[model samples]
Target: MPIPSRAALVEHLVRTRIAGDVATPRDNNLSHYRKLANGDRHYWLGLELGDRWTDEQDVLAVMAERCGVSDDPEHRAGQDTIDPELTVAALDRLAARLRKAAAGKERVLFATGHPGGLLDAHRRTADALRAAGCEIVAIPGGLIADEGMVFQVGGVAVLERGATLWHTHSPVPMAAILDGLARDGSPLPDLVVADHGWAGCAAQRGFDTVGYADSNDPALFIGEAEGTLQVTVPLDDHVFDPRFYEPMTDYLLDAAGLPV
Candidate 1:
């Protein structure tokens, strides 16, 4: 895979509509921030946030700095953005962690709540890390959580129910993974690469966790702020085409010095 230049990645992000005036509008973004501030556990994404992020303005500030959203509370209805530079910068941080995992030959678990959009990216990263001597943590079968069965497809953990892969924001699946590993005397992951509840729960439990988040999801960013999460990259979690993530993933792997 060719490594995309910084300029090229930025262009891809804006042109592909993954960032820069994205699909998630400002009003929806503010709504989520408000709910998160009001102590909605659903917005907590599986972490026990307590009162660390109860201020709507505080959450908006983090999103603006880390996610490139507008900080103005008055700007409630127009377009929002995921700054391409911040996205690339956060990807650099994520790559640093993966590079260390590879160098240490560490046990790394990769999971995704965003199967439709991020599955390929996770798979590509996992495959690269495995090739570089990291152990891709196994997703144990028969594991169920959050009313959905936990399963692995193409080496990435995801939630499934009713014979369909379900999109989830619950951390129960990660808990099940850890519990299952303990029961079998298997080693816990040295690092967890995931998003949604998977990343939140792992980080809460003190694991080295890194993952991605969209503009509306502020828990991972809060976790980073609170010193629990390693790093969380910001992007639109879902683009209409899964293939849209290829360039970003390629850039990430390249930055991590891992061969595809």
Candidate 2:
């Protein structure tokens, strides 16, 4: 398939529910913003939000500006949005970084908390980067983290517990991965492509990190707001079909000038 044009990509985003009026409820979005304001570190993903984001309104403002949610502090129910244009703009920015990584043959690490939804996207991007001369960083061993073992599968790291690969938002796995690399005397990645806590923990540790985020996940946007993250693309990270992401990723790679 050919890469989608910007207008076509925007249409795809809304039509397939990747952006626009997403499934995440307005109440749920506000609840997360409030929690982040209340210093619930879980909502912080992995960054230390501290006293800066104490006001829920402030958090909402950041989300609206970056994630394209509603800015109205009074209207707090029903449907919320992820602006397709903002999503596209951020995708372009993320692509810029990927392009640079490919050109420089930089070491890149890719991870995902939404394995069921985003693992394939990460894997595809990692493969492209690796083939473009970027070193696809690997986990040293099956590192135990948060009671689950981290394993690299199909070019991305995911946590497996029991017989199931788990979906997680905790930064412990990323912490464990970074620690393992250090212990093995391996050089750290020049760039990390990830979502959820994987991206957050890396940004908090001062890496050039870029990734996606849902309307409810505000930490990555806040991280970008505070200069901790390189970029954060606003979208519904998980949709009804994982296939919906293919076009978006293709749009990204296409924009980045990577072979798609």
Candidate 3:
């Protein structure tokens, strides 16, 4: 069975319910609202974009149209993209528009297709929302590079230096902590540290595979034989809170018990 797209689902919901005057394309410019038959205020997420290749807006518009809310413009109603760069541009534009619409709205949440990638994009989006005076909560990414390293190394003779190297050029895009086992030409990992995406982890898990979140948790440091390890690396809780970074020269110096 084929699953219906978001637009289809929203269109069905709108058509079955909602009875009110919908703003026309021009009136939908901004600050458009509809009073439902039950006196509920329903704001449209994509009211201005009558017909556009926006997944979120198209879904919201379809909902309005189905509920007799009016989409007389016959806007483009589906996702169509041949160019990856263009798609990313479109996404940025859509995010800007949605953030603008979120102004003065209570509890507006922006949903994205690529959440992990969205973490990378949060700086701009979060700033826009803050400027708009909207209450926004951008959840932290599930994992980071260093926390992932501790999880990968487990407890393989904690080097006094606490330095690790990542093999970024390998066929697989993963960070490799050079433990004694890796240097000793051992074929099997003490435990597979699946810090990459689900597919990436699945492919690398010829040995026991642990998910990224599972490995990063500080409570599960059972040891290499147990296929479990965890560590709490201090993270800066500024704008991008909980984002882990490699210990700086000063941090390393401090960790080495040397006065800066």
lDDT scores for all predictions? 0.91, 0.93, 0.25
User: Model 2: per-residue lDDT, tens digit, 1-260?
Assistant: 87899999999999998999999999999999999999899999999887999999999999999988999998789999999999999999999999999999999999999998899999989988888888999888869999999989988999999978899999999999999999999999999999999999999999999988999999999999999999999988889999999999999988888878
Tens-place lDDT digits, model 1, residues 15-87: 8878887999898999999999999998998788898788899999989988999888889898989999999
TM-score of 1: 0.98
Better of 2 and 3 by TM-score: 2
TM-score of 3: 0.20
Candidate 2 regions exceeding 4 Å error are none
Displacement of the residue 192 alpha carbon in candidate 1, Å: 0.3
Identify the leading candidate in terms of lDDT. Answer: 2
TM-score, predicted candidate 2 vs. hidden true structure: 0.99
Instruction: Give the least accurate 10-residue stretch of model 1, judged by summed lDDT.
Output: 139-148
Enumerate residue pairs that collide in model 2. none
The predicted structure with the larger lDDT, 1 or 3, is 1
Sorted on lDDT, best first, the list reads 2, 1, 3
